[model samples]
Target: MKIGIISDSHDNIDAIAKAVEILNNSNVDLTIHLGDIVSPFCFDWFKKLRSDFLGVFGNNDGEVLFLDKKSEGVLHKPPFEVEIDRKEFILMHEPFGIEKLKTQYDYVLYGHLHKVDIRKTDRGCIINPGELCGCLTKKRTMVILNTTDNQTQLITV
Candidate 1:
């Protein structure tokens, strides 16, 4: 299965829209947003995702209740876990929490730092798709992860 990974959109609607188009064209099975989505209005771009989508709240996310209302049934508060195709995934907005359970999940995803990081470990892998907002590092990026073979491709927006 293919999974689309994104984070730190920071209310960049155009970038988010472009990324969604790419992910949809790739025929990803699902998409995961690591956080820093900012405002609830960004959910509109998220709603354009063609596959199943899920997200975790970031430090900047405001109006928790309203964000939930706009999430379209796929937002989790954070430090959430889910098992897919027997692979365990831990999702959060900050990488600090993931440091403690580094080797416990098949895939640990988080954003916060606005930098792309993909590392392999004895147990699994950790990935950060970078800042979709382009506020830092001046690059908007995302990732497509193939669960079957553990191959990841970084997409620059």
Candidate 2:
């Protein structure tokens, strides 16, 4: 199955809207977010549209419960795991957590730095979707992963 990944949105509604448009065009089975959705509006936008999403909390995610209140997606605090299409996927908001969780899942996804990159370790793949808000890095990005075959792709917005 095709899965879409996004993170560090930092509440840029326009950017998230663009990313959501891109994701919707990709024919993904679902979308998973790494965190920093930014504001209540951003969270509400996704909740009102899509029914499939998973997320985690980042250091800058102020008022966590507020975002969760409108989330149709899954949110993780630190280390969280889910099996999609029979493959185990782990998610976190920080890179350090990815390093620590390397050996525990088939894939480890994180976001903190507003830069998009992917690395393959002995245990699994670590990916950062970057900041879709395009604030710090002046670039927006997202990721797509194929749960069945371990294929990954990074998309810049």
Candidate 3:
């Protein structure tokens, strides 16, 4: 299974649209948003995704109730744990205590710093797909992870 990961969209509709297109074209089995989505209106772009998506609230995500409604209850508070493809995964908006969580999950995915970080540890992998809005690093990025092999491709959209 291939999972698409995106984060820190910050309400850039254009970037979000592009990312959705890329993920759809890539035929990802699932899409994960690492938050900083900013506003509920952003879901207008996100709704185009072909695959189901899950998300965690970032510090900038203020309209929690509406976001949850917009996401149809797929959005949750940070540090959410999920099992996908028979692998344990933890999703969070902030990279807090990631090192400690690494031992517990097959994948530790988080976003907040608006930078791309991907590394394989002895236990699993740590991934941050960067900022989809390109507000900080001036580069829009996302990730596609193959669960079968645990390999990831960093995509700049």
Candidate 4:
């Protein structure tokens, strides 16, 4: 199964649209947003995704109720745990205690610093797909993970 990962979009509709196109074309089985979506209106782009999607709330996501509604209840508070393709995964908006969490799940994914971070551990991987908004790094990025082999491709969208 292929999983699409993105974070810190910061209301960049263009970038988000591009990322969604890429993910859709890539035929990802699931798409995970690491938050910082900023506003509910961004759903205009997110709704275009062709695969199943979910997300966690970032610090900047103030309209929690609307975000949840827009996401159709797929958006949740940070540090959410999910099992996909028989792999245990933890999703959070902030990279807090990731080292500790890594030991417990097959993947510890987070966003917040607006930087790309990918670390392979003995058990699994720790990944942050970076800022889709290109606000801090001046580069829009995302990730595609193959669950069968645990391989990841970092993509610039």
Candidate 5:
């Protein structure tokens, strides 16, 4: 299965739209938003996605209840875990929470710092899809992970 990962979108509708287009073109089985989605309006665009979507709340996310109500299918509370294709995946909005994990997962995903980072540890693969907002870094990016082989490709939007 292929999974699309995105984060730090900070309400850049155009960038989000572009990323969604790319993910759709790639035919990802699932899309995970690490956080900093910022606004409910921005998430509306995600409704157009063909793949399944899930997200965690970031520090910047406001109106939590409203966002949850509007994005019932997409939002997942932080530090959550799910098994897909027999691989366990953990999702969080901040990297710090990952350090406190007691169990190992096949993939650990988080977003906070607006930088693209991919690394492997004895435990599993760690990925941050970077800033989709392009506000601080001035570059928009995301990543697609091939779960079958645990390989990933970074894409700039």
Candidate 6:
């Protein structure tokens, strides 16, 4: 399955819109966001863009009540082990937790550093799609993970 992965939008509407359009056109089976949904604007943009957003809570995320209310029916993989297609996947917003989880999952995806990172080991892989909003990085970015073949592509937003 083709999965759209994005992180740390930081309230960039135009970039998010473009990314959403690209993902929708790609006909991805689903989309996973690494959070940093900032505020109401961010939440609204994601809600209007598509329905396949599976995300998590980031450190800078504000408006918890609002986000929670809007996240109903949204499949948010917690900061824990989440299984997809019988393959173990771990999603979180912080990276430090990875040291312990590296051995537990087939893949680990996270955000918060605003940098694109993809690494592998004898056991599994870890991926970060970077900041879609260009928060800390001047280059806006996102990632497309093709689960069918275990490959990932980075796109500049």
* Model 6, span 49-86: residue lDDT tens: 54366788787777766776776645353585677656
TM-score of candidate 5 against the unseen true structure: 0.93
Better of 1 and 3 by lDDT: 3
- TM-score per model over all chains: 0.95, 0.89, 0.98, 0.98, 0.93, 0.89
Candidates in descending lDDT order: 4, 3, 1, 5, 2, 6
| Per-residue alpha-carbon lDDT of candidate 2 for residues 43-141, written as tens digits (9 for 90 to 100) | 656753343787888888887887777673367787677887776788888777566677777788888888887887775577887888889988888
* Candidate 1 vs 5: which has more TM-score: 1
Question: How does model 3 score by TM-score?
Answer: 0.98
Which regions of candidate 6 fall more than 4 Å away from where they truly are? 48-51, 73-78
RMSD of 3: 0.7
Candidate 4 global CA lDDT score: 0.94
Local distance difference test, candidate 3:
0.93
lDDT of 1 by residue, 22-54 (tens): 999999999999888888998877888889988
Among residues 3 or more apart in sequence or in different chains, the pairs in candidate 4 whose N, CA or C atoms overlap within 3 Å are: none
What's model 4's lDDT at 76?
A: 86
**Which candidate would rank higher by TM-score, 3 or 5?**
3
Q: Residue 36 of model 1: what lDDT?
A: 81
Q: What's model 5's overall lDDT?
A: 0.87
Tens digits of per-residue lDDT, candidate 4, 1-157, equal 9999999999998999899999999999999999999999999889999999988999999999999998999998988999999999999998899888988999999999999999998777999999999999999999999989989999999
Using lDDT as the measure, name the better of candidate 1 and candidate 4: 4
Q: Over 4 Å off in model 1, which ranges?
A: 97-99
Root-mean-square deviation of Cα positions for candidate 5 versus the true structure, in angstroms: 1.6
